[model samples]
Target: MKMKLELFLVVMAVVCAAGKPTSKAAAGRNKLLLISFDGFRWDYDQDVDTPNLDQMVKDGVKAKYITPPMLTMTSPSHFTTITGRWVEDHEVVHNMMFDDKTNLKLPHKLTLKKSAWWNKRVLPLWITAQNQGLKTASFHFPGGGANYSGQVVDRVLFEEFDHPDDNETEWRQNIDKVLSWFSEEDFHFVALYYGEPDNVGHAKGPDHPDRKKIIAQIDRTMGYLREAITRFNLNDSLNVILTSDHGMTTVKKRPQVDEVIINKYMDLLKLTSFEILDYGGFGILTPKTGKEQEVFDALSKVPNVTVYKKNEFPESFHLAKSERLPPIVVVADLGFNLNSRFIVYVNKGDHGYHNGEMDMKTIFRAFGPDFKKNFLSEPFDSIHIYPLMCKLLQIEPAPHNGSLSVTENMLLGPEGPAGTEKPGSGGSQGASLSVALLLCMLLFMSDVL
Candidate 1:
């Protein structure tokens, strides 16, 4: 009897010792759901009451501002958030990029079947996680469908089948599908994208009544998502991060501006040697061979616009580091857009301005097992978010520019420096103590017997 009891206690000790490490590893494997509301400005929640978002802020961490990468456009910004690299580093410098190497133009409208436009330089979080044996799903997210480094996400809903619109029911259906994915045992990470407030913000200005209505609708959808997470009891196990690619700003057509200023100079500057890509608020001028000075001299003289030689562009913006960038870049002042005859009507709102502009800032909110509650973080560069995602998922991050230390303070418990104990590991010491006590009790009982 004594021998049996001793053997049992020894086995129990081994089991407890083995189970503790598993628990620690499992604790780090929380589900992460990243949701992007494209063009959702940082202040939209402030302009309209967003109870669901407000509740999330009250329950999770909120950043004061998320400064998007330079160009402040959707594709580049989204890729930046995922890859933690600047436009120059990632090579997806604009929403519509032309690859000179393959002579293939990649527009936002291009199908996922085409992969040449995606940057082969960097690995996105989904690929990183997937490579580490985690299942990842992307729903209509930029770069989600494209295979990076020869590895595509485990599941993807390319833009052709899944496009974002103003329909709340359709949005809910997407959410339902995401929830169902979360229910799957193998689904570990997911990214969801919604084009909202952005679509309406373009048709109607950010402050327009219609825009406000859509913002409210977005808030309601968020509320539904929160309710569903609670209903499924996944609130503590799942992390939901909401952010936007860039914010929108009101824009007005500069009547005949392109014709009077840009067009007139184009003929005089012998612009045939240059490729001028105009994006309403900004333009990129790629001068062929020796025409750089000529293109810069003409556009630089134009009023209400700032022009920079590619090398002279602000280093802080991180825009000029890539050879793919044009020789000259021009940006119009806020509230003004470059005029083009092809445009039927000036968009009421636009982005793609200098990222430092406050109007270009976007939202950042996170709720999950890993984030701190009721904490408001100071403004930080969006590049840092990739490292935060890596930390939360406990995945080894690929080599990138972002530093986890920048955003580590926003997590709960000792996972952050300020916290008293490390997250998930807090229970391990207690578990050890319990096992020791049990061993002691067993030893005492055996001696008595």
Candidate 2:
């Protein structure tokens, strides 16, 4: 009887050992499709007319909200999303940038590879994914035009579309282009960025009728992507993730800009350009020269705007600590926005508001074979996305300042029966730690016995 019991115990141990998930399948090749819709708010996921995105939520996982960078501009927010680093670290803080050394202030262009202001040390996810020998592609990534050898970037389409200047219309073509590319290439990872909703939202405000129209347009585009993937028989092989850089809020009121107050300190400050631009609620005063302190003090005395130095910006904004950030960052009081000559001419609406307000919370969702069904709900940081994509494509995580990979696993659920290890919940490598402790305890017990 004792011999029989021993043999049964050994068989059970063997079965248990075989059932444990190993690192092999986790490190295996898998395809990833990362898409971002600019200015896509959290409210769009409601039971309204979103048939395409609603299906994705039912088929996969969705987050309550995703946080954006401090400045909340396209350059910075999108940069943070792709590289998992804040604007200060990546150094693309605003759409209009100033190079202090050259005394050159230039409107931000999506320059490929060579910009004095952008920090290239913080690599993008495509770089890491490509380094692992997986194919990669990007469509209209905010700064995706830059050709940094640091990340493994394969095919990048960075130019802006000319006709139909509406982003929603152009986005449909971009999505079709990406689907065609996916069909032709054996790409292991791909990213597509849509700038139209953000464009319309900024131009028409979040509550404008055009904002809802843009949402519908995006839904149709998403449907095309989902349908194309299915038709190509690549659905099972693809991990589709969708998110946005930031959200949009309505401009309830516009603040008057007193040219007299601006001029009082304008010449005292080394004058760059004196135009005031709406930076969401606050305005950005870029000195043609780098007199940040003078500009900041001048702006601080204005009605309800609080001035924040580049360094003084909250750490939660995750702006890289840098001297190059705009000299005077202004925050408008609630219910107020800055009325710039530029804004009056173009956008009827805009973002770039207080860094900490919940109004800026954006949307994030994932639908694919690897993602769990209807699992995630709580809000998460945008930084977590890089690591999750890396895991899906079997690439090394980008070296970043503490991303939230473990917290994001709520999207994946208890790791599948396949060899993919469950990403830990609290950011601790708990499964590995638990295994080590168990092994040590077993060895100690064996020696004593």
Candidate 3:
């Protein structure tokens, strides 16, 4: 009898061990598609009809809005999404890479391929996923093409020079290509990029009719992407995330408002050794060694522009600690543009302002079998997206600033036998407990036998 009980207990232990979800396949790792439609504002759909975007909200999960990191440019903000670190930490400080010693700023396209600018001892999502036995493809996602610590993305596509941003045909072609990558090539993840509404926004302002037209195009693109997913038979196995880097606001142009021209306040060649001005809303100046305070003082009095010493920059911005940042940083007030010397034309729409502005908030939408249906979450920071993607991939992530706790609530529980409740609702654990209790009852009954 004793020997028989020992065997039964061994069997019970084995059963319990089998019940635990230890293997990767137990939870079913789903592939991910992270798509960024550059400069799609949080409320871009509010003024326009975006049926596809509206359908996304109904079919999946949506956030109130997602906030981008400081120095909110294309490269820095996108880097934050992948690295889960602030721009001050990741150090992709701007769209244009600045060399303080040479006082030269590379244009946006050149900066995309410059390895030194992007691989700042950080592993972006592509390299991180690759390190853990997954394949990744990047379709012109900013920072996706750069080498990271001697490692490169598995597959990459760079946009041809002056590629038309509004080519709907090519956009669908890229979508088909991405679907092929997942369905035929067995790619696990992809980060696709689109330049739209941003280009229109830059030229026509956020509220212009042209902006609305581009937005309609983006809506159609969303519909096409979703339809393509179904046609490729990846609807059940893939998670799709639609998001943007930053929002666009109307630039307060001259004649309507005074422009913030720095040279008008202080002589550029005399007081500053280097200046990164004539951009939209942000400025960085490397004062001639000892002219930091003078430059700060002179620029402080300039109307519509706020200047700061590197150390004195607002801690809330999360970008002041970067080595790449110059000593003097200036930001124009909302809707204003900063000029280096003379009054010059600026984009009708611009970003890179303090993120607290409502216009600076962007959009986030996540859809997949793993996510809850028709869920609307409160606003979250974009940095948290990295950890969320890592979780969806079921891979261990390297040390990152984002917390999985912030995003896990949006996901449903792991799949088990049918009728299992979600993870947080205690269904799996409850089932395990019930099984243990039944085993105990059986043992007590066996004592009589």
Candidate 4:
């Protein structure tokens, strides 16, 4: 009994010692805030009157350009952001994905799984932080806040998909919900995903005047968010990183690649069926049987069309990295577009091809404790965000592919082991917010588990 008491005392002492801070002065030591401004452009705020985003750039490090994926679509880009694993490795190759393994589909819906088996990227930063006992939160990212690793995430804002189309009440509700998350407690790490910019940009095209208004509105909302965090005195410990899924390009003219062309080519050669999938200047062509070369040659004859096979694409593009892709790809030059038989009747801005054209430029701005105060001139991958956060939060990286730690250059403080500090001021604030969100997650996890 005496020996057991001595052992208990020793354990308590160790816990107390571990809980004590190495320096009381390092109060702003443990928080990270990541924000994603959907469809943010390289020069989005150049002419706009976006005060909050402009201030973030002035106060933090802004990337000159976050080069988008060759595919330059939404889900792939977003997957790159959170996982820090490129589509080449993370396996969310495109916006419309068909997982070859397991035959499971990830349609535009939130998924909840028993374990970390669902996501292509093994462990995201938030999950890693949660595993290390660091408090983490997410607000309406593309993939629903399903905790993959069974631990670590403290809160996830539920996305309401009941209304497919945009509603004013629902949009405002999402913003309020996100703001409430930050107001709760000292939050070590928080990620907010705002969908208006991307949603509207796609709906109205990037050139729409409404797009600018939407961008400004979201910026204002971010300002409100910043004010809330400051009002709660959580800014010093917070790092606000703002980025986008992909950039946008205006569609010029839509031209059909023609059934006549396919029929003529087939008559001259041997083939079965030819199908075309259309989106703006991008089109995916599938040839029946193995006559891809004949189909490519026929499509190349079309005015303002350049065709390439999957394997012929550049290695840097990363489009050919996955096998779940069409055989023939079409890229229409500037002021030109391609369409299927159905899309010839419908025309809209789209992004899903590798074009040498520079219109599809994405943007990134990071303001907070972990970044430098000037432009980050270095060309960094969007995937770098994954490991960068890992280093910032000091979490051991979960099993993943190609996410290298960017801590030494990114963080301002000592790069010690993760989650070593006692329950932080942010954790208390986060815990308060976590109470309500935890209940929601429990219900959510129960339904999905």
Off by over 4 Å in 1: 1-20, 26-28, 99-106, 111-113, 161-164, 254-261, 274-276, 340-345, 414-449
* Stretches of candidate 2 exceeding 4 Å from the true structure: 1-28, 45-47, 101-103, 109-119, 149-152, 161-173, 253-295, 339-346, 404-406, 411-449
129 in model 3: Cα distance from truth in Å? 0.9
Cα lDDT of model 1 by residue, 208-303, tens digit: 999889889999999999888877668767888999899989876555343324654555335534343446567676666676677678777777
- Say which prediction, candidate 1 or candidate 3, comes out ahead on lDDT: 3
**Cα lDDT listed for each candidate:** 0.78, 0.66, 0.86, 0.59
- If both were scored by TM-score, which would come out higher, candidate 2 or candidate 4? 2
- lDDT tens digits, residue span 111-134, model 4: 432123236545667776766666
* Predicted structure 1, TM vs. truth: 0.89
**Candidate No. with top TM-score:** 3
Point out the worst 10-residue segment of candidate 4 by lDDT. Answer: 257-266
The TM-scores of all predictions, comma-separated, are 0.89, 0.77, 0.90, 0.72
Candidate 4, superposed: residue stretches over 4 Å from native: 1-29, 98-118, 145-154, 162-176, 179-187, 254-276, 334-336, 344-348, 374-379, 399-449
Predict model 1's lDDT versus the native.
0.78
What's the best-to-worst order under lDDT? 3, 1, 2, 4
lDDT of 2 at 316: 74
Clashing pairs in 1: 414-421
